[model samples]
Target: MYDEKRACPRVVFHAEARLAGADQFFDGSMEDLSRRGIFVATAQELAVNDVVRITVLNTPILDLEAKVVRCTDRGIGLQFDGALYN
Candidate 1:
């Protein structure tokens, strides 16, 4: 059984997303969102501990800074530098 170790609950949220890293850019979509992090579905390659700027397209939200925490064949998991608040 897998353990749910997340500090915050995640909600199903689909949104077009852009990831910007040093000399790297990826177009992806967010599958789930939480106050502390998000999971982005993308084929683009990224490494753990990489810093990236995230922008949710067509939204009023400002750009967010995050760090890559987990990577899988399906997507990458990111932890925001700060909690996402309204």
Candidate 2:
């Protein structure tokens, strides 16, 4: 199998996140994170390319808007909108 190449920086951390537009909250650990993206594993399934708002643990005041890049049976990979950070 061919390995996918990543262009962004990734940092691992244990964090709590919630999906936007959904009232139900999920407890998941952050697999990786960067200023431009994040990867998280949760029980709920999220659609790829879906726009979502996520709040990281200990950073409640900073809600991030991101687009789903990949979705698996257990988790989601999100790409943050560059415009949101500027």
Candidate 3:
């Protein structure tokens, strides 16, 4: 059997992510992150196509803006606008 790998790279860290245009924010733990996108889990309900800004703890210098591509009961999948990570 061939094992399928993720199309995007993922980073493991605790971060704070907020939805743009929404007054709500969530404390999330990044499951996997890449320059292209990131996966995070939070208690809030995020709809698909929702634009958001993410700031990783201790790494606030890099402001990441992304759009929600998918959302599950536990987490959300985001796609970066451009080169979000260097």
Candidate 4:
């Protein structure tokens, strides 16, 4: 089994999310979130290390900037540039 090595723990969260890359933009669903990063379930393909703008479509409309760290057949993992939310 693989060891889970993370500074922060992810929380189970679902929300409407939008991601904008350099020239591509698409809508996805936010699966989970933590202080340092978030997991977005998007069919849209994004390369690792790609910088993207993330907008959480909620009543307050949370906006954040993140980089693609991991990618899978189901979704993508993103790491925030800085501490946007606490």
Candidate 5:
């Protein structure tokens, strides 16, 4: 299956991810990655379209802003402007 809202194809990836809001924080991992977005495996519930800063632990891309696109039982889909931290 392909993501219709994605600009690039998604790839299966495994990376540490942290989502931080103004008053909340979630610790999770990035389950997959695309050019413009990623699927963050977070257990905590986040509202759709909510903006969050993503920090890939120990990576260069710190505090990347992303909009929540989809929130499922497993995780949340994030749309960002740039690449996912490698």
Candidate 6:
């Protein structure tokens, strides 16, 4: 069984993520969106604690500054800087 350790509810959706301040981008599928953070399923090479702009296309969240908290071969987990609502 998987335990939910999230503070906010998350919605499962696939979206594109653009790395801010870098000339790199990729399609982030199997994304879990929430007010606190998001997990994007991508093989993009990234390090922990790296701040990047996350633009969730086809969703309300866009141009959001987030820090990479977790990075694995499957994807990355980002903790957003602020609230996401629009």
The estimated TM-scores of all candidates read 0.88, 0.73, 0.73, 0.87, 0.80, 0.72
Q: Return model 5's CA RMSD, one decimal.
A: 3.5
Clashes of each: 0, 0, 4, 0, 0, 0
Q: Write down the TM-score for model 1.
A: 0.88
Model 1, residue 64: C-alpha shift (Å): 0.6
Q: What is the lDDT, from 0 to 100, of the residue 77 in candidate 3?
A: 86
The 0-to-1 C-alpha lDDT of every candidate, in the order given, reads 0.92, 0.73, 0.74, 0.88, 0.84, 0.77
lDDT of 3 by residue, 1-86 (tens): 95647665556655665444367666677767676888888766788988888776666476678888989888888898986646
lDDT of 3 at 35: 67
lDDT of 6 by residue, 1-86 (tens): 97887668898866666555366666676488888888878878788988877766776765778889999899888888887773
lDDT of 2 by residue, 13-56 (tens): 67777667345555566777776788889767777877877777
lDDT of 3: 0.74
**Model 6 clash pairs?**
none
Tens digits of per-residue lDDT, candidate 4, 29-84, equal: 99778888889998999999999998888749777999999999989999999864
Which structure among the candidates has the greatest TM-score?
1
Point out where model 1 deviates above 4 Å.
1-5
Q: Model 1: clashing residue pairs?
A: none
After superposing candidate 2, which stretches have Cα over 4 Å from the reference? 1-5, 22-27, 83-86
Residues 1-86, candidate 1, lDDT per residue (tens digit)? Answer: 96778779898999998889999888998978999999999998899999999989999986999999999999899999988984
Locate the minimum summed-lDDT window of 10 residues in model 6: 13-22
lDDT of 6 at 75: 87
- Candidates 1 and 6, the one with greater TM-score: 1
Number of the top-ranking candidate, with lDDT as the measure: 1
Clashing pairs in 3: 10-32, 10-33, 11-32, 11-33
Rate residue 83 of model 1 by lDDT: 88
